[model samples]
Target chain A: MSYKQVIYTTAPDPAIDPSLTTGTFRLNTVPKPTNVPADKLLVRTHYLSLDPAMRQWLTAKRSYIAPVEIGAVMRGQSIAQIITVGSDLSSTFQPGDWVVAYSGWQEYAVLGAKEVEKVVLPPGGRPTDAMSVLGMTGLTAYFGMTEVGYPKEGDTVVVSGAAGATGMVAGQIAKIKGAKRVVGLAGSREKCDFLVRELGFDAAINYKDADWRKQLKEATPEYIDVFFDNTGGEILDACLARAARDARFVICGAISQYNAAKPQGPASFMTVISQRVTMKGFIVFDYAKKYPTALQELASWLSQGKLKRKEHIVPGGIEGAPQALVDLYKGVNTGKMMVEVAPVSEALNAKL
Target chain B: MSYKQVIYTTAPDPAIDPSLTTGTFRLNTVPKPTNVPADKLLVRTHYLSLDPAMRQWLTAKRSYIAPVEIGAVMRGQSIAQIITVGSDLSSTFQPGDWVVAYSGWQEYAVLGAKEVEKVVLPPGGRPTDAMSVLGMTGLTAYFGMTEVGYPKEGDTVVVSGAAGATGMVAGQIAKIKGAKRVVGLAGSREKCDFLVRELGFDAAINYKDADWRKQLKEATPEYIDVFFDNTGGEILDACLARAARDARFVICGAISQYNAAKPQGPASFMTVISQRVTMKGFIVFDYAKKYPTALQELASWLSQGKLKRKEHIVPGGIEGAPQALVDLYKGVNTGKMMVEVAPVSEALNAKL
Candidate 1:
């Protein structure tokens, strides 16, 4: 049997220079492994999650984790299915069970027990919700608000890239958690309106607005309490200047400055002191253990019509992974971006 | 008897373009206050403490507190004495009982109990320690370090403006708290030695050095657990980048950036998220109630030879107020800078 995977031609270099994003993704074919053991199964990929955090893997440097080596498979979370089992084992991962796995952007990935956490889809929702509203991105918003952002009722909470996967959920979650005025800042007017109308945000500001900072100041006269920052750089610095006393700044990503050769610093940092604010960062991987609780709660909200789940699906195959991610970075994808691999097969199932 | 009180006038609208350091200081005469109550005492100013924070009062805009109104007396702490008693309650007042007052840049003033807090000097030594070690500046360092910085034994700590009043005592407190390495960032070469050698800091880095950032990285390779920052621009930014996970950055005073019409903004904040650091601003006025405990601890340390005190005294009446404060702004004075308004009656008595 043959498995198609998104293989790496060159790892991200240390400089974070232009070469890192020099279309570093590629597709390759690899031979299937031997027969799976009784406790293992093969998973045929249905979806591959693309995120900005993956950029960190491309660089070889002293970071929170080891960098992805050159010519290795790119790591990611995906929704996949068990096609074939080598032997009858625990019922948790029986064939046809739709599950979430760290299966990378690959077609036929092999896995052992506990390698994937099965996604229990709601009555009417698709499996993609597991990767968006109920997966790592969902947990990122959940914990980022609870532990870092410290959301409070009637508080002015601003979120950057408000239409992106994480930002949308983060804004909605802030509103759900009783933020009185949830301000969404996105690149396009459509995304801004979508944030305000579709997600129950109190207001939406376009980052492209020439007077966005002045508008933000007028909108939040008392200053912002929590800033769920995804797109860092100038806007993040603007929010810092407008932060109220004891404000909480949650840094989930800095996409606006991430791809640059030299990341731009904050434009006004004395506010961090003058305003008595707190800024902290966390990784969703750090909160992996809490996924079960997050998934259950999110699924409950989704089924009860309290939350909206969105997914941007890309056709699965070895060739589409690179452009799929590129489209994601371009802000083309609305929700959790995924790629469908092959029809459920015995070869893929045996490794699940 | 008639007396003329002196006041330093603001050079009518003193607005520094923020890109430059040049400023003007002026002196003017004030009419003596004609009202005096039974409980209110007439304070003949002695030594007027000139703190770097005075720069804020010269401006006409809003800051942490309202900037000193033009034509209004400046706001500050002054060591003074009772000149005349209005009531027959001789038991309540002597011709000269030394006290601390917030009478601003004036030679004669009337203050109620709320304006004055009595000083109980040490039995064996000069009472100057009250202004430098047990005063607001000393207490500022004390509570700012223990409460905000929270240094633990064996933890490395870096204090910016390390030879200034607050930083000087802040580093000493870190040492007393059992910090393994107390690193200091001071302005001059002599201050660097004064910090590490005389104050027993494990390391000292002169921020004036061209390779200061490199020296900071080398001196604190293990990362600093606590950063007691009095200077908050580039040095603070550099330390923020090199901060270890869970490091605490306490913003006691951003002296380096305070006088700027608009601070040049913090330049290296990405590390705040990457390192999960915490930074907070504080004012000594907020911790006024806890001064007794802080003063008690610091006074005991001074008595036990565990801490040293320093003061830069400028002699003259209220006419010297503007120049004294201007000298402080130029970093001309070391330790606590004060203008000797009049001889403390007790000091003269002791000399007699």
Candidate 2:
């Protein structure tokens, strides 16, 4: 059996908003290889992970990691099945076994046995759910807060892009970690409502509001003690103004400024001096070594029914992929923004 | 016998460009130590230390430390002679012993014994030299480089305000630490020449040039690995733009921005994310405990004549103090700005 691979085909991205992710994957049908090379395994992709970082990876610039070349399939974390295996890469399963691999943006791929970890799915869900709240997005929020944010009890915690996968989980984590107030800044009223009503955020401020700065201060009267900033730019500047003494500003993502012609600088940096603030930027993949612990904690919270997972699943094989990528930058998707290839059950679709 | 104490008095500081300075400090002194109690120590001030941080202290707002209140005798670091040590608070020093203390513009002061620390003269130099080359300024150069800059052997270290007291020393230290290139950024062609010819800086760029930004890039081809910034504002913004990966930007002082009604924020701070830079503001006083080690090392450097001590001393008694500070803010001072209340030697005659 053979499958298709989405590839970066052109460099005609608009200079103003230069992420022209057009979905038209290169499809190929060839006989499956029977003789695998040493340390090679066949992976039947169960779910493909889609993230905004994929856009950055499309360009061959000096990003946290190298971008995907024009001819290669885009890079991502994937869950797959073992269709066949060679003797050297053979494990427990003879021909059929469920496994998680990082063979990205493809229906099926060949991966080295050591290249991917077998994610034993939780009792409540499938692998697609594991790719989100129970996976990297959840872990990114987990370590960013506990390690970088380090919010103490009664500390005011602020999160940017609040209704997104990471922000939603981060704000809730801060609350669970005994934050006195957890304020979130989002782009729209719907996200604001989701943050406050669903995620238990103490307050949510739409950054689109001109009075957002005032609302932010009001939401955080004591000033923010720890700011888990996923989206940087004016919101980061506003947070800088209201940062309490010794506030921790974690730079998880700068989604707001990433696509601009000239990136936004921190305007009120003098506040960092007056407030003795510490701002640190990190790549989520750098902390991949600690994901198991992060996943364990997130899974426990999910299993206890204390945590919620919401994903905006976009369907179609690889045709909707490019639009999904463009829509992500526009903040069109409501939640985790996953592209589904195969379905689990129709009853599981009821939540959507 | 009662000797009339001399008090420096300025009618008021005349305004220059408000953008360059918030305002000038008028050194007004009342009757000095006329009511010195029997248990108090009457100390005669000899030398006053002038620094950029002093300008910030004179402003009526919070900085890293509390601002000096208006109408109080302008605060300064002065090396003074204990004229009369009263019986009540006497132990560490006797009358006539030289000591270092925060004695302002007045020629004589009634100080508590606890307010003075006896100046232990080193083997080779006069005590007032202690305030610049071997005192707080030297320590500022030390910690700002070692703790913050952390320049590796092959890394290029750039120091702004490069001909100033701290900057000159910081560049030498970076060279001593085996830096590949040490570049200096100064305000004049003469200062740039002096930095390159006299100080051993690899290249010197005059920030006064119309095309200084281009000159800076030329001087530092690979980009600055460690930026020891004293002059902030546009210079800081430029440095941020030219920073290398994992650059350390140690903001010792922002003399250029200090007087501005609104501090200019960095235009290219997003470079911090791209370059993985870390910018931090630090005051030398916080590292006061390391003064001994810093002093010992600097004293050795001075004795060997490896370190140069250039004092732009004003000739007068306490009356010259206010104008000396004004000249510093005007960038008129050649090197370490200081006010001589009395002569250092026979060649430096007593103006009084």
lDDT score of residue B22 within candidate 1: 29
- In angstroms, the error of model 1 at A282 is 2.6
lDDT of 1 by residue, A225-298 (tens): 99999988888889988888788989888877655566676756666655677777777767778878877877
The TM-score measured for candidate 2 stands at: 0.82
| Index of the highest-DockQ prediction | 1
Positional deviation of residue B131's Cα in model 2 after best superposition, in angstroms: 2.4
- Kindly report which residue pairs in candidate 2 clash with one another: none
The top-ranked prediction according to lDDT is 1
- Binned by DockQ into CAPRI classes (incorrect, acceptable, medium, high), candidate 1 is medium
Query: What C-alpha lDDT do the candidate models reach, one value each?
Result: 0.75, 0.74
Give per-residue CA lDDT, model 2, range B211-262, as digits (tens): 9999888888898899998888789899888888778888777778655666
How does the DockQ of candidate 2 come out? 0.34
